[model samples]
Target: MTTFAPPAGPVTGALPLPVRRRPGFSLEGPFYTSAEIFAEDIDRVFSSQWIFAGTEAEIPRTGDYLTVTFGHQSVIVIRDGDDVRAMHNVCRHRGTRLLDETCGTVGNIVCGYHKWTYRTNGELMFAPAQPPNFDKTCFALRSVHVRSLDGLIFICLAADPPADIDTVAGLVSPYLAPHGLKNAKVAARSEIVEHGNWKLVMENNRECYHCDNHPELICTFFPTYGYEPDEIPPNLLPAYDRFLAAENDLHAKCDAAGLPYEAIEELDGRDVGFRIQRESLDGAGESFSADGSAVCRRSLGGFTDKRLGRLSMHVQPNFWSHVLSDHAVVFSVLPLTVSTTVVRTTWLVDAEAEEGIDYDLDELTTVWNHTNEQDGEIVARAQLGVSSPAYEPGPYAPSEYQVEKFCSWYIDAMNAGEPRPEPAGRSTGESG
Candidate 1:
């Protein structure tokens, strides 16, 4: 039998617990800076929810595998035969970490500590010095709940994950299937560590109020996002009119292709909150380049038209993506500690598209690469300000509705006493 060490930190009694968060307002300072609340976030939010791990494109072969680590837990997402499986990355015998590398191909999972061996399917195959009565069947690697929705992978650490994901998958698959993300290949991937809590990173992404800081992105991405018709200020009305015209053109093209373009927003008031839509871009009304033209020569899913706009989707807790005609970009957030987080960005292009011939890697990734760097600086400054004793919860503007919804869902999950996993069925909850 193996014994594990306790967490390295002062006890909860030594610190001041966070105050209860108020609705329609920013979370209290402690919620972002306290060690106690950070641990609770890992338990109530990360562990209990289905997190976007990685895409199937990352593991196109049988032995391909990747390790996702967050809040002291690690999971191995691997491809075995025709199925994708997720297992806790811990040796069953002595509780040692089995795989330390971020990603690689492996015929079998072998523990470095004691040479315990397991198949790609997570079945225990060998244990060198076990008792005669020991049973290999009883020592199989523990499995984590994993599901793939149109090639995007999600994993839940809880024994009974939220069932609302099935309903979410059904509604969003039509918008995603046309892009062929499952068959796509990664063009570029990068990681940046930000000096902020995980929630701050997510909250920063929920609104475009600070988009002026992203000049590269604004060249193609309209600055009128997250605003309703009535809320459009006079300064942005002309841009709004341009957006309407481009939207009309996009709708006509989508109708001809039989693709879903209308928004389906249900940001809160359910087990799984999500929003998806295909919106028009500025300039040439295409990809993320400076002039809004196609970034790659080959189109995704064999679509001839480059003006398909972007199929954008946002999932609660931590996931968002933008699928364009020529390529797609996916973002995943992981917590490192109470005061830091890591954001991983991946760019995907057609599998047959050659890097130098069909697409320029720098041009394909320049927009988002610069945008992320700017966002990271903003989050860091926000963290610094909120750490001061003068900081207080502030009201959220109407244009920032999604941020409020995200905070509400998080607070609800934190306050939901114990796990009451929803039954397997579609949720009929009202849209937000």
Candidate 2:
């Protein structure tokens, strides 16, 4: 196995990142092609903010854990007693890396280099040949700030994470709670390494302007996602009409069930940017299937209504999800390099629901599986284009407003965070 490691410092580039950008336009090539900017993104954007890690249902039992990796850092998110906790996945002794596997249950975190052991709660349990002066408390694994909004897990590596996470969570949890993700089980998961900058992957997801590229997705998915009522194109007018009718029905059902269906979009100008709404799917208005019918037979959260539509949410930097009555699909993005990214998509369903009986494995996963592949190709082409010297930033249509917001949020994040210092007086300039 290749032991993963990050670069010592930012790789130098010819052009520095611009502080300001014109509204409704794509970022300049350097933002996508520069390794220096990518390093800054890893530090100022990923490290200092509350990132969507995983779901609580992932580690439902004590000792269960998941590992999240991004750039230089690896974090272990584990269930400790009744609480979920996160810690740096590094052995306190000798700085040996711990928990190499992507995920597995462990009675205790043990360092292979030494016999240093830690409890599931991260307390140092045992260490051979320790000096009398060595305090076990001091040797405990360094903890990361962790919080869960109902079931979605988030972690912050910073000493003080954004305080707005609580505010965002409070506003989002009620809409997410009814899906019962905390009680759900991961039905399926798909991970892909896309040849694109992390920003491109997120920017692609922020709007449906390019959704026409996803044929399988556009079947039930309303391509009118980011379009304003007046700004909607003539070609998509029929879809807009259908969307309006379905939204009315969805709102009525939500009201009857006492669920929140209104849109809450605060995608920018916040420490923890996000957007959420319970919107109607086309056709049967149930799920992402070709006919808009649920792939899972079992309903989530004991919802008697299978046509509850989809509760979709997007968090800045690296996460988005859609919760339907039948199942919930969650996605998280992580950068591997300046021009490569990893996208993980997980499907969750009722804990008691059995596979093959309550849901067909293929049907549960097919729509998004195809959509993700299609998106990967698009991002790869985009990466290639942006890397070319002839490439120039392009204008974004009005329907691409969310994409503009995402870029705005990214710029704000990069500007607001303190710059990371270069290590050992290393120059962050072009070094052949």
User: Which residue runs of candidate 2 sit more than 4 Å off their true CA positions?
Assistant: 1-20, 425-432
TM agreement with the true structure for every prediction:
0.92, 0.93
lDDT of 1 at 177: 96
CA lDDT, every model vs. true structure: 0.88, 0.87
Q: Between which residue pairs do clashes occur in model 2?
A: none
Q: How many times do residue backbones clash in model 2?
A: 0
What are the clashing pairs of model 1?
none
On residues 294-349, what C-alpha lDDT tens digit does candidate 1 reach at each position? Answer: 99999988999999999999988889999999999999998889889989888999
Per-residue lDDT over 218-298 for candidate 2, one digit per residue giving the tens place of the 0 to 100 score: 888998888889998899999999999999999998999899988999999998999999999999988889899988888
| Model 2 deviation from native, Cα RMSD in Å | 5.8
